[model samples]
Target: MEIHPLHPTFGAEITGVDIGRPIDDDTFARIRQAFEEHALLLFRDQDLDDEKQVAFSERFGPLEKTFSQNPAGGTLFARQSNLDIKTGETIPIEDARMVYQRANMLWHTDSSFKRVPSLCSLLSARIVPPEGGNTDFADMRAAYDALPDATRQRLEGLAAEHSIAHSRAQVDPNLLSDYQKSIEAPPVKQLMVRANPVTGRKALFIGAHCSHVVGWPEEEGKRFVRHLMETAITPDICYSHQWREGDIVVWDNRSVLHKATPYDSKKYKRLMQRTTVAGDQPTVMQ
Candidate 1:
C-alpha cells in the first residue's frame, strides 16, 4: 500500500490495500507509523461491514463502548444520523435529539472529559449529503510548534479541566438531567501540552471541553483555554474532509481536534458511524 500526504501539516490518504482482511505485521507497522506521522488517515471507497470495521479497529487497540446518550450505546458503534431508526423518518433539525448533536460542531478531542481520553477515533461515512456535512481536522502538533517561546513556556506545566457537562451546556442544557449532572465527571488535571507516546512529538491538548486551567480564576482560565483553541484551529493548521460514501477516516484524538460543518439535514440523508479506541492510561494526579 502507498500512503500519500494530504497536506504538509496534517492528513494522509492511503491506497492500494483492502482493510477488510487481516494484514501482516510489517504492513500493520507501516500503517501505525504513518498514523503517528500524519495524525489523520483517509481510506477511500472501501466496502466495510460492521464486523470488518470492528476487526480493523482492533488493530489500533480495544474499542471504546459507545456513549450512553447514543442510540448504539453499549455497542462499539456510535451512530451519527439524521434519520430515526425506529420511526424511519428524518428528524427535524430543531428536534431535541438533533440539537444535542450541535455540540459536535464545536472543535473537540473525543472523550476528553473522561478520566482516560480516547487515543483515536475511526469514522466511516455510510451516507453523504450532497451539500455540506464536511468534517474539519486541526493539527494541534503544528499549532504547538508555532506558538511563541514565552507562550509555550507558560503552558508547559499547567493542567486544564475538561468536562462533558460544560460541552452539553453549550448545545442543550435540558438534555443533561439532574442525574447526569450529579454523575461527577470530576475535573482532570491534564498538561496543557501532550507528548505523543509513540512519536515523542508534542501537541496542544486544549479544546472546547477544556473549561478552565487548574488553580486559576475562572475568567482567566477560560481566556487561556480560548486562546489555545483559537491558535490550534487557525485555517493554516486545518484540513476539511468532505464526506463520500464508503470513505473511512481515522484520526488521532490525542494529537488532533476535529469539528463537524453544517449540512442540509432537511434536504438529504447523512449517516456516519464512529468507533473510538481507548487511551493507554490516565495521566492525572489522584
Candidate 2:
C-alpha cells in the first residue's frame, strides 16, 4: 500500500488496500504504523455496511459503545445523520438532534469526557450531501511544538477537567439536562499535554471539553484553556477533509482535535457512522 501525506504535519491517504475485506497481518502492521506516524489516514472508494464497518474497525482494537445521550445508544456505532433512524426522514432544524449536532462544530477530542479517552476513531461516510459538511482536524503535536517556552512550561504537570456537558453548553446552555449531565463517568481529567506512546511525540491536549485546570480558580483556568485552544488551531496545523461517499477515515484521538462543518440539514441528506477504539489505558489519573 502507498501512503500519501495530506498535510505537512499530520494526515495521509492510504491506497492499494481494500479495508472492506480481511487484511493480512503484515499489511495491517504497516497500516497501524502509518496511523501512528500520520495521526489521520483516509481510505476512499470503499463501501461498508454496518457489519463490514464493525469487522474492519475491530482490527484496530475493541470499540466503544454509544452512550445513552446518542441516538444509537448501546450500539458500537455512533450514528451521525440528519434523518431519524427509525423514520428515515429529515429531522427538523429546531429539534434537539440538530442542537446536539451543532456542538460538533467546536474543536474537541473524541471521548475525552470518558474516564478513559479514546485511542482512535474510524468514521465511515455512508452518505454525502451536495455541499459543506467537511471534517477538520488540527495536529496538536505541531501545536505543542509552536508554543512559547513559558506556555509549554506552564502546561507541564498540570491537569484539566473534561465533560461532555461543558462542551455541549458551548452551543446551547440547556442542551443536556442536569440528569443527563450526571450520567456515569461524565467528568474526567486529562493532562494539559499528551505524549504519544508509539510515535514519541508530545501534543497539546486542551479542547472544548476541558472546562478548567484542577487547582486554578474556574475563570482563570478557563481563560488559559481558551488561550491554548487558539494556539493549537493555527492554520498551518489544520487540515479539512471534504468527504466523498464510500470513504473511511481513521484518526488518533490522543494527538489531534477535530470539528464538524455546517451543512444544510433540512435540504440535504448526510449520514456518517463512527466507531471509536477504546483506549487501552487512561490518559490521566482518575
Candidate 3:
C-alpha cells in the first residue's frame, strides 16, 4: 500500500489495499506504524459490512459499545444521522431527539469522559450529503508545538477533568434530564502534555469535554481550557474532511480532536457510522 500525507502533521491517504479482506501480520504492522506517524488515515472506496468492519477494528483492539444515550446504544455501532433508519424520513431539526445530537457539532475527543477513554475511532461514510456535513480534525501535536515555552512549562504537570455532561450543557442545556445529570462521569487526570508512546512526540490533551483543572478555581480552569482549545483549533492546524460514499477514516483519539459541521437535515440524508477502540488502560493521576 502507498501512503500519501495530507498535511505536515495530521492525515494520510492510503491506496493499493482493501481493508475488507483479512490482513497479514506485516501489513497490519505497517498500518499501525502509519497510524502512529499520522494521526488520521483515510481509506477510500472500501465496501465494508458489519463483520468486516468489526474484523478490521479488532486488528487495533477491542471495540467500545455505543453510548447509552444513543439510539444504537448497547451495540458496537454509533449511528450518526438525521433520518430515521426504518421510516427513511427526515427528522425535524427542532425535534427534541434531533436537538440532542447538536452536541456533536462541538469539538471533542471520542470517549474522553470514560475511565479508560478511547485509543482511536473508525468512522465510515455510508451516505454522503449533497452539501455541508463536513468533519474537521485538529492536530494537537502541532498545537502543543506552537505554544510559548513558558506556557508549555506551566502545563507540563497539570491535569484536566473531562465529562459528557459538561459538553452537553454547552450545546443544549434543556435536553438534559435530572436522572441524566445525576449519572456521575468520573474525572480522568490526563496530563496536559500527551506524548505518543511509540513516536515520543507530544500533543495537547485538552478539548470541549474537559471541564477544569483539579485544584484551580472554576473560572481560571475554564479560561485555561478555552485558551488551549482556541490555540489548538486554529485554521492552519486543522484539516476539514468532505465525505464521499465508501470512505472510511480512522483517527487517533489520543492525539486529535474532531467535530461535525452543520448540514441541511430537512433536505438531505447523511449517515456516518462510528466504532471506537478501547484504550489499553485507564487514565491515572501522577
Task: Name the candidate that leads on lDDT.
Answer: 2
| Among all candidates shown, the one with the greatest TM-score | 2
| Candidate ordering by TM-score (highest first) | 2, 1, 3
Candidate 3 per-residue lDDT over residues 1-286, each given as its tens digit: 9999998778999998899999999998999999999989999999988788889998999999976676566789888888776787887888765776788888888988877879999999989898999999999998889889999998877888887778888877766666655664545566677889999989888777898886899899889898877765788889999999989999999899999999988888988888899998765553
* Candidate 2: segments with Cα more than 4 A from true spot: none
Report the candidate with higher lDDT, 1 versus 2: 2
In model 1, state the lDDT of residue 126: 87
lDDT of 2 by residue, 1-286 (tens): 9999999999999999999999999999999999999999999999699999989899989999976667676899888889898999998988887788788899998899988889899999999998999999999999999999999999998999999989988989997877778865468888889898887899998788999998899999989998788756899999999999999999999999999999999889999999999998877778
The lDDT per prediction is 0.86, 0.90, 0.85
For each candidate, give its TM-score against the true structure: 0.96, 0.98, 0.95
Predicted structure 1: lDDT = 0.86
120-147 in candidate 1: lDDT tens per residue?
9999998899889999999999999999
Assess the local accuracy of residue 165 in candidate 2 as a C-alpha lDDT between 0 and 100: 89
RMSD (CA, Å), each prediction: 1.4, 1.0, 1.5
What is the TM-score of candidate 3? Answer: 0.95
Q: Stretches of candidate 1 above 4 Å error? A: none
